[model samples]
Target: MQMLPLNMAAVTTVAMWKAIALIGLAVAEAFVVVSSSPRERSVSTQLASEYGASARTRTRDDYIDINRESGGPIVRYDGPTIRPLSNVRAPSLDEIWESTMPVIVQGGSLRTWSFANPQVDAVQVLFKSEGRPIDADIDLWNGPDNTPHKMRVYVEDGARRTFSAIIGTPRGPNSIAVRNIGQLEFPLDAVVRPDMQDGLAASIASVVSKAEVIQGGSVRTWSFNPVVQSVAVIIKTDGRPLNSRIELLMGPNNSKQVVEIYTEDGVERPFFAIVETPEAVGSVIRIKNTAPLEFPVYASVAPYTLGEYNFVGDSNSFNEWHML
Candidate 1:
């Protein structure tokens, strides 16, 4: 009788241990399944039929849609005769602006130039690729809406020069085109406002009374930019410790901007000046000179529009640029 009881207890103990072991294993497997959950992936197709035409579903079908678009740059076109897109990933701002030139496309993929509404389809890239750029052009067009528009583009001289321009609203979307019969002499270096200034240095004069204060962001690494080649930055001390700098920014594309900081001592080295952008309309360069370190700084811009037009030029703790 005693032996039978002992044997029964032993069998029960073994079964209990087996059950606990199985339960532990189940818990472990559950943990592994949860930990190894796959990440949610987003779609990136140039012309996916699902962009807006279909009810695209996300694995994380959270109703609150988010615009977490991450992928290579995109450039597309649509018109009476659309051609296959070329390999234009994040093309230079100058390249895109060239399409705005007065181009009369007669046949093939070549059509009259038109400034595509960047806010809708693309972001006007203002700078070219890395290195000194050698390619350039200008495209012109007549608006299909009985208006005319013009665009000037600085080739992605990679890094040869910095080109920048600021247009008043009157020169921008105000009208399709400015029908001024007369043309101005560009070779004289007398740049016009609101158009592509290619590569030149001009002053806004004393706009302090007309200027507004802009709060700045963080500093970033020092990188070269094609734009802002020759620039004169005039800052009002306004009783602050913020020292301004001249940066050789390329574009707002990939890679951080490059810079050649000029101080009151003047530019220590010769800044290679590329004239007549896209072509040498009359390219020229001036040897390095003293950069004004006065309360109001002055810089000369040329080459192409430096990548970072954010005016985010700030000083680090020690006065070095802090790339934001």
Candidate 2:
């Protein structure tokens, strides 16, 4: 009787295992069915459509449709008649800025141009591709700070894309870069204009402030033979986001003053103090930059006086404080 019960128990266990195996197989088949659905496959096409109205949904069967379409950069209509202008414009290098150039970038490459003068307020990029659509990112940097403003663009092959502007500050040299993030290599005609005409006259006539600090950090001490009566310091950080502590010391030992300032991310910190001396005495000012990052500090001293624009030019630590 005990043996019979043991056999029955073995049979029950086998039946349970079979049921579990069937359930697992059903789940795997359901997952496959969902993943291969038409809805899942259309995701990429939907994303491409959102980039622009001209962007077409590309697919394996749609290869003929893409090829039938003509691609090239868009031409600007500058006259009464909408005729395509010649890429080869004025015969002089000085007039090259008013023309377009044919640029071919292979798959997975980037082109960078540091052709912008400080007067260039913006850059205009108009491009069209042949055969295959091109995907690229337009990068603009105000200076060599390595921080770039990026915009993603999609170009339909054989069709002209609308020109896009990369805006930047008119201060310092700007770098315009185009990165091909797509897998296809094709010829593209691009009209890139470094627009410097707008506000050019105004910029030339405008007086640049001498109060702007050059660079900060490193050397921090300044000693003057006859100490100034008062000192002020202004600290501003670049956009990289930083937290730093700045300590300033000024005046002689008898009436020495120490000011402690803390800077949080994105905020400018300031410090000011006056020195009291029984007589004309030598004074030293010290400043420190704990978060020593490039473009970390913009410093300026107080009281307009005829002194070196970089008054603290000799200071080893901070460039913002100058001996009057």
Candidate 3:
């Protein structure tokens, strides 16, 4: 038999090393399964024992080591004010007579709303071309007080957004309508006191992302509330194609940092994909329309479906998901 070349011998040695490593890993895994309580030995346990050497765990306080093998985001809820929208059973926001902010235009003025004890989340202000004036559910995050919230009017379709600068300065009913949004419940401090003339302690903060809006849905929504201090949705469609803009509200609506996306058509299709879950802080928004119509509200809230999710976080009041 011809002897192997020098280079070939080196290659053989490397391959042997790799093979040995793989075998070692397999053996470790088996040992873990064999060592664990027979009843407790599961696929997860076996894999963990074999490759993922137990980090450390002691009976005392410092003895317990957090094994982070999942390599996913560390889901945490430590915010002071946080909760779900349904906790307080908010009166489904159908109509709101908000006090619009004062604005000096070409000839008239508009008073933007300052709701009493303004508890709003998934809140919006939508306008109807045919029905009574629409309401825009503008989510207001926490921020410095006395800031102005503004929206330029126009038409939109699909992944496109257009704004028609009102010929010159904007005006009345013909002008775009503005109102405070309300969903399952009023968010923390989103309400104004009966005594205070303007928005109470509720200053705008960072708004959550503009949830997925594929099929023709447009409206402002937040991931959490301040009062109920939880999470919820507030969606309003104008029949035409729409794109959801995730607005991060900065102090008194001083302005908005916006992020947007379209939704999957609920009528004919359902976008199905098991998106690898990021850290726990990330929100997994699955907007599925169970009904055929789209107007006032959306289908039932999730979690209740699999009888898993829909619970307050262990630490805070924000919404928490459960896998069934």
Candidate 4:
């Protein structure tokens, strides 16, 4: 055999090693691709378990450790990125209502609370609005003792608020009067008493009457003698177009309190009529469907005397405040 130069022989040896290394790398890449498949990974996992490796393989192309702890397979992350937890706290009902204090209008001449106690002349006014804040004159004169007491207070609106105000004693019956001082009308609620918040002592509402569907051009009537003062009348269109009239008759004279509801968009909206009766006498709820269509109606009258509070509702002008 003819001998080659020593440098050339060394170069040839280096080239042979490089070619082997490249071939090995290509084989390794091909094995990776094949093992990454679901079927191949499953088979590999089964074989690993049979051989005492107990390897766990996932469907996704995850970077997993094998024989990591000598007992079980390690799980690696190959899915979507996980999000960190948030630390911000949401506002409570009381905090949210406090923030609704009228920006431009500091206070109003509107008298919000009126009470006539033989011992106390002024009591705390706990007020809340179902919708946005309403600027209204509350005519609290509901009885013989309720002298002409009218006050304008910025009734903070939203959620079930129990904010208190120090105003003259609320007048009339437990039920008060609300008139929209602003051009627009909104649902308003108020509780009058001292040393408490709304619903802190109020009883959980009990269902006096179940839901009933009233046909078009018909009337559904319910009568009950309330032992307490507060009565909640709920009317819903059930997502159907509705134009109806709701009447709450109470007192000896049978004073008719009417609410005309018309849902133009056919949205399933429940209109609440919180009726503060003049007395715990005989009360009647009469719903008449003025529209020529069928609609569902429900009413629950809970007559509970909140120990330290007078749970009252607006008697007149629900037209201005019925968009609950």
* Number of the predicted model whose lDDT against the real structure is largest: 4
TM-score of each: 0.19, 0.31, 0.20, 0.32
| Candidate 1 off by > 4 Å | 1-125, 139-157, 160-162, 167-324
Candidate 1, 1-324: lDDT as tens digits: 435688899999999999999999999999999989997665677567475445565443333222235221111112112111112232233444455442221111222113443322111113233343322221222233422212233233434443332322221223222121112211111112223222211222221123223233222222322222222223322433223322332234321222222221112111122222221012222212122333332223222322222112121211232211
List RMSD in Å for every model shown: 20.6, 28.4, 22.6, 23.3
Alpha-carbon local distance difference test for all models = 0.29, 0.42, 0.28, 0.43
lDDT of each residue in 1-324, candidate 3, tens digit only = 889899999999999999999999999999998888456535566777655454444333333122245442233224322222123332221111244332211112232433323223212232222211112322222233411123322221201111111011111111222332322222111221121112111111112223344343434223312222222233333333223333333244422223232332222111111111111332333343322334222322121111112223233322333321
TM-score: model 4 vs. ground truth: 0.32
Candidates in descending TM-score order: 4, 2, 3, 1
Say which candidate scores most in TM-score.
Answer: 4
Query: Residue 69 lDDT in model 1?
Result: 54
Q: Give the distance in Å from residue 35's predicted Cα in candidate 1 to where it truly belongs.
A: 97
Give the higher-lDDT candidate: 2 or 3. Answer: 2
lDDT of 4 by residue, 1-324 (tens): 999999999999999999999999999999999988876335446566665542344432233223344442222222212111112232222443465442221223233334444343333334555546655454435465643333343433323222333323323133344454544345444444432223222111232335666778888776643232335455555566556666656544353444555543233233433443323234576778777755544433343221111113222212222111
Off by over 4 Å in 4: 1-209, 251-253, 265-267, 294-324
Q: Output the better candidate (1/3) by TM-score.
A: 3
